[model samples]
Target: MKYHFFQSKYWVIVWSIALFFFACRDPKQNAKENVKEGELKEPQEENAHTTVIKTIPGGVDTPAGMVWIPGAMFDQGAVAQDQMAMGHEKPSFQVAVDGFFMDETEVTNAKFEKFVKETGYLTVAEREIDWEEMKKQLPEGTPKPHDSILQPGSLTFKKSKSSVPNLYDFSQWWQWTIGASWKHPAGPNSSIKGKENHPVVHIAYEDALAYCEWAGRRLPTEAEWELAARGNRKDKIFFWGDDQDLLGNQANTWEGEFPVMNTQQDGFERRAPVKSYPPNDFGLYDMAGNVWEWTGDWYNTNYYNEVSSKKQLLKNPKGAAKPFNERDRYAKEKVMKGGSFLCSESYCASYRVSARMATSLDSSLEHLGFRTVASVDMVKAEKN
Candidate 1:
């Protein structure tokens, strides 16, 4: 009887070891099976109502400057004679895009402050200038140890004298001020303490990059930027269709006499609150005004021509390998779309949807800000 019991125990031990080996060999399979079972029990929920007629919650405070643009295609370039005269916005093309979300407004001072406070990140303009790197670009006799060049600085347009003519010239308004950064917008004395609602200026591309990375999103590409701004219409002049001034309402931009006297007819002399105006047909706010937003594409004047020639629908098209002119030297400079609150007929007329401009990657201006975009994941129902 004792011998028989011993043999049975030995068999039991062997079985246990075999089971352990089998389990170890197929751990991944077991995990997959468990996942499948979970998935079967709880299927992913979809927003059954495909049409986004109503704005959803969590949509309101998606970082200031971001417009929630429902993804759809529109004419990508200029359709009118005025836009054609702008040089680069020619040969309009039908662009169909997948639905996606975009920021309703330009990024604001308050929103950027939250990003900086959380990450303790320093903007590129805040960092010290590398004299050696700058010297390499200049001629041999170029002044070294120059106060202006060596100083850590950023772009800040000095207020031109009221008497000065052509105050609208960008040069008059833009000044490279030492210690001028997002933190110290007007240099050392300025602080963002109470100006949180204002648009954060003096941000270089690197600064925007850092903020976007922290936020788990990215700057929109040029094609994506234009598409979102155009809404669901053909290449109309502005985001709100062909008429620049609709219903006798001035959406944005400076009024009155250029820099000397901003009439503030549009209710703002500088950057206004995001969503200060009504949204476009696609629920995008401030597509034509407020602040110029940056795009990922490198600026090339002939890029639109190339896209037009293709006659094929280009999905997420990025612009030229090299920049077109001296306007963009840093290669740091990328395309900026839409115009700003400072835009006026007498001065910069970049409010048009097809309008484009470029800014240095390391440069930032009071009128410069940005918005965010994401790829559309679903087909949206058409609006009535």
Candidate 2:
């Protein structure tokens, strides 16, 4: 069946379920009971309308370029004191958000193949390179690299052994293989074959947009994405909490030696199943680990400073009005939140709740995915 955007009528029905029951019960008394059970209590009936408690399902499957992130605000950005823990997550602030639906997991290879099959869509990587587009933005006299060099693909790490005791070269692991699109993730000769359940990788920003459009959804904005990932926690290191090792099991990561020898404590060297790990407080899965998901906001290292300076309540703050920077100049590098499996404490320690990063809009990787969201009407949501 063809994909359709989430319908408002469905949510209205969900809200109705919440309100109808609460209207007949005493909320204050219920709140106490809820607390005892470690559950969120529905607001007590103050007026004719009563509050409803709705439980949404988590970890549903979707095609590539999608993840489900239950809506709720925790903390956005980071502060100076949290610098050592998370630098980019700076300028921490409390952001109140309404309830909304999100993808339960990242888009998988099997799902993306369906989109390609139904729509016959050619991803940005499959299209021919625009030489003029490339030259217009590159520095003067850069010797216009061969089209072969500019071929569409993603960076994949090739596992290798290191002889030096202390000199493990990580650069050797990252290879920009040609023909490394979603269909052939490892290069021309590779295929999805039995890996349909794996997260779809090597997809660029435009590629994600196409799939979202086909699926009747859009990429989450940076704020929406982070808020959903955080799940109502403020100033915490990881999504679950400050304690990184709360669960002894490693969640979607390379354990052992950096790129050379992986202990596979997480069960896989590459991407893991969408629901392999536990969910956050909001019932969102794979927020902290797995593949990094893309957001709609443009990348700016100092965007937090601007967010802090603004006096207005940034209801749904989108980044800069126009694109900036070299990456932005080309196709506008969008913000990427939620560190990937490649993240390690010793090297790229970005797997924190508030951390942020960016990549070229046209570039896709085996380590990126996305999710969707919608607004929640307070009056309607309460009634539900």
lDDT at 97, model 2:
42
Number of the top candidate by TM-score?
Answer: 1
Off by over 4 Å in 2: 1-74, 79-86, 144-150, 160-172, 247-250, 324-331, 376-384
Q: In candidate 1, which residue ranges exceed 4 Å CA deviation? A: 1-68, 81-85, 162-169, 246-250, 326-332, 376-384
lDDT by residue for model 1 over 1-384, one digit each (tens)? Answer: 000000111111122233110000010110111112110111112232323322334323333434455555455777765632365667765554444567666777888988988988877666665555544443355445544445665655455566456432344465556676777877878887777766677766667777776766678877678877776664567767777667115367867655566777778777677777887776777777777787766665566776667665554455555455333232324688877776666665777777777564544666677876644322121110
Error of 2 at 222 (Å): 1.5
Give per-residue lDDT, candidate 1, residue 255.
70
The lDDT of model 2 is 0.57
User: For model 2, what is the alpha-carbon lDDT of residue 244?
Assistant: 62
What's the TM for model 2?
A: 0.72
Q: Which candidate is the best by lDDT?
A: 1
